[model samples]
Target: MRKSEPGRGLSVPRTGWRARIADRPARILLLGYLFYAAVGWGLLMLPVAQSGPVAPLDALFIATSAVSTTGLVTVDPGSSFTFFGEIVILALIQLGGLGYMTIGSVALLVVQHRISRRREAAARAAFELPSPVSIGAFLRAVFLFTFLVEAAGAAILYPMFLRAGVESPLWAAIFHSVSAFCTAGFSLFATSLEGYVAHPGVSLTVAALSILGAMGFLIAVDIWRTLLRRRVSFGFTTRIIVSVTLALIGAGTVLLALFEPTVAVLPWDARLLAAFFQAMTAATTVGFNTVPIGNLAVPSIMVLLVLMVVGASPAGTGGGIKTTAFATLFALVRCTLRGRRDVLLFGHRVPAEKMRTATATFAYYIGFLVVASGLLAATEAGAAFEHILFEAVSAMSTVGLSMGLTGALSEPGKILVIVLMTAGRLGILTFGIAIARTRPDDTAAPQPFGP
Candidate 1:
């Protein structure tokens, strides 16, 4: 008998597409968002989902926007879609806000009473959780906190909407509450919260929800442990997130109050409240505007652009380069300028890896803004440069704020914004990693000599 090869008896592991995708957490996240976007697109295309005839591309744009939680609508959602469609959009917002894996993990926990190692790994990767944080506890906290906060928001808004003579007060309350909490920014009113600009209760409640959501689930978990469980101290990450968030909101509010022409016309109290609300919405990436974005003076628009670019904290419902990344970049620049070898934030040393990641994130964001803005300018004839740039930044940051350009976007412009929103939701770095080939870490490798 011919002698068999020594290794021929060994069973080889399968390397199918599913197995390949399952091996990479980033791939799983990318595919998950895409899958949801496709499903949402299909649902929105149904006749029952619409009150009026919707074009295929517009449906796709709405689906992608909802799934990304970017809220740059080509059509007025309230008038264009039926109750079923609005429900579909709201569901997509929740899914996107929670991180797509969160719902799956929650469902698995309910059914199996445990999450698989692979699933947990994917969740961890998606959230970029630190090694010390317990995945199970974190996920449980996220679900509990999100529901509680959203419910409270809805309850508070119900009476306010009822008092406002809204036709569907209860529905409107629930929808806006969820939207605000998710930082999804979808408004039933065509004018957003402009009608409630002077209603301090409504504006403040919505702002509170947006702030809490933008602060991230990690902070919630930290708070729960420190206060409720009495097991741990407040974390450094929480401190950084809180301090930076507060600083931005305070500074933006002051600047807007002093400079925004629209706010200048309001009564003193309303002006301050309007400034605070605008600042909160921009920094939180909530995107709801109480004033006309198109009419904002150049200085005010610049302030909003800065706020939107910095955006919310890590693992938060909102998007952008993120507050952590912004903090890291600021520290890196400060240290470099001072000729210090170590990068420090609040007297604590930032890890080299974190510094590198922050730098990469900043580079990617600025680079994409330039490229996308250029393409948009090319596609949109006669549009002002600032308007085109604003649209690009808003989409890339997932801020959803527009200067009246969203509705007038050319077909190519819509496609470009769709890509930007998807990328922003996935995170520029995470998306980069998902598409790029895997490579071993070279952190410890010796540097090559160069001139």
Candidate 2:
């Protein structure tokens, strides 16, 4: 590893990792995600995936949602699929959740983003790297972490499901494990584990998969390296993800239990468990819901709304504002409250640019949710605006948990979600990567631009 440059704090020197990330492979990964989404959409348009050839918009919607790992389906995935078709959707979910690029770029990057300037910028922003330069090691680390976790989750789950007497337990176990880790929330079951609502083994296993997978590959890498060396650097992502994740879980637990008395049918312990589970489910962007989210108290709905907005870790399948983004935003508020010059967490100063990034992410996320929800609500019959908003958020966050409304969406409603899912799966900023233009420092001339 190259030594740090003179002025940068905690950022690795530019010539090493950054340069590698700026190669063709990284660009390929970025392009692959869009391509895969298109393919998935194309498949959904086929009669095999649906009863008949679906309307282009509806087919595209289902495909994008599956590829994005958002469970906001316009049709019932359970009923819409023939065995072969459902398998394709499941495969798309796995691919989408793991990130088509992240998985496709499985081999470590050597030199990436060599051709596309937009890809370099997108990769830099997406990975939170200091430079858009190459980082073979980091990408490699991320892929390794992902594979191990998914494999481990699958190993544990498959046997359990088998013992529980599920036919095709092997395939079911592998699919769900991958889905959970990718935080895609696409399930084979029609009602999404409604039958296993309180099955501690099943639900808890899924929950563990959700949490671990949504923790973010970067965090996982950090944790593994830390454990190996018996020390932890306590990087910003680690500190924030750990603290905020815990707090959200606690807050969610209390809010779900306090605000919803409907779960009283379940024992207090079970209800509490379910409440905490929902909290984690939302925070992590893992769409598995042991209890139906729609039937809950309105307050619980609000709580979930907040949780969904907060979302999961960065650089992984889960979506939303992300824990770090919210953590920084919350810190900015804290700094204002204390009259401090900088936002602080774990006694480390949050960077000024980081605060801006957080604000932008949060803003864009909300903007999309609002517009998409409004569009869908306008098109769908017998759907509440709030439900539309929830569905939009689910699609945008790539969190698939939905009210029963999804199966009945109009063609237009389905198209709206398809757009949201594609955007969400691409991390909202990827479009920035797609649209952004960059100039070399040497040849770049000063350009007049509006602020």
Candidate 3:
């Protein structure tokens, strides 16, 4: 028998080990989140990070929520966290909402003066930016637009906060502005913009910021380009996202006004304000609520649940299944029912891969929603089933709106929610992909994410 080369076999195992670590981008992304969450959790546990001693679980919960940009909290951040703690949370929200990959690309651009092909590939994989939009352009536009919009929102909110007797209006304005634009839904006010329900300026400004953030950077870039160039050439995705957003907002506003008895009792102007704000909150996956979420009727809650699950557009700050996925699945069903082989959007054929991804993602969301809801039901059995289900969907969607159940959840229930919130913010498919490792070769190849 011929002797094998001495080092060749050893080299194969080393190569295989490196490939396992390097190739799984999805797993790496997931680990990035866990690492970030751990860091944030430790920071929150520091004496300066909170006003008083905090339970490790609660600290972890807050860290996960902040890192995921899911606002479900067991404690009131305003009363419980110190100024330093709030700053830490704000930083987490920024990092979490923009995504670590996008920020890393920005850092690369700053340091290297250009993104390497690998970095570009990473950004593209993370954000799913289409061919028409270059990574540099998208990064620049998203950063510029995010700050500008946040600045505008802060400018609008500062005076209102001052008038409302906030001790540190500037801080309040900046905090709320960033929170709204990131769709993080973390608020200094314990009631969560409830007192501002009748105040159009504050409510509307927050809603507008939420809308912009949830619209996704792609749509923002499209809008900015059209306005700057005096041209109107938006893509099909942008068109569908805008159309669906407006329609959902309109329908949600009407439904909330009609079905919510508390909202119905308000004067016409107040009712309109409540309706609009709630609609915006639900559709954008922004958790700020003008009306008491618990007071809403069952049907009204169902509407919100649907909106939360449908969520915002792809590559956006908000979470859930996404607007385009909902559209794709709807289109798929329509085509299939009609015996049509191709799914057509704006007279263009939709790719089969996207359809399958959308279908899988949708199924993932539904399946998980049921399992999580059932688990919550068992753990927090004392709570109403509807409220438990609502909480589960909200956490999974990264929408923070709750029916007063978050604080009452058992420790295990809270942990479950933390997991759901993390999963929701990362996205169902992304979470799944991260857990299910692919072959080294498969990981090396570029794979498309769902729309």
List, in order, the clash count of every candidate structure.
0, 17, 0
Model 2, 1-451: lDDT tens digits are 2466678766664464344445323444556667887887777666666765456766666677777777666666666667677778777877776665444344324444232444444444555554522544556777677778778877888877888787688877887888788787777776777667667777788888788777776677678679988997456667778788889989999887766876668888788878878888888888888888778877888888888888887766688878888888988999899999877977888888888888887887777676777788789868987787788887788787776667777767776777677777667655444444443583678788987
- The residue-level lDDT of candidate 3 at 156 comes to 95
In model 3, how many backbone clashes occur?
Answer: 0
Best by TM-score: 1
Task: Tell me each candidate's RMSD, in Å, in order.
Answer: 3.5, 7.1, 4.7
Q: What is the lDDT of residue 19 in candidate 2?
A: 47
lDDT at 104 for candidate 2? 34
Across 1-451, the per-residue lDDT of candidate 3 in tens digits comes to 1234586753323345445544555655666778888999999999988898788999899889888888888999998899999998888888888876788788888888798765676566566667778888799888988899999999999999999999799999999999998898999889999988899999999999999989889988888889998999698889988988888899999988887897998899999889989988888988999888998898999999999999888768888899888888888888889999899876778898888888999999999999999899999989999999999988998889999999898999999999999888778987887677555485386779997
Return model 1's CA RMSD, one decimal: 3.5
lDDT of 3 at 85: 93
Assess each prediction's global lDDT (C-alpha) against the native. 0.90, 0.73, 0.86
The ten-residue window of minimal lDDT in model 2 covers 107-116
**Positional deviation of residue 382's Cα in model 1 after best superposition, in angstroms:** 1.9
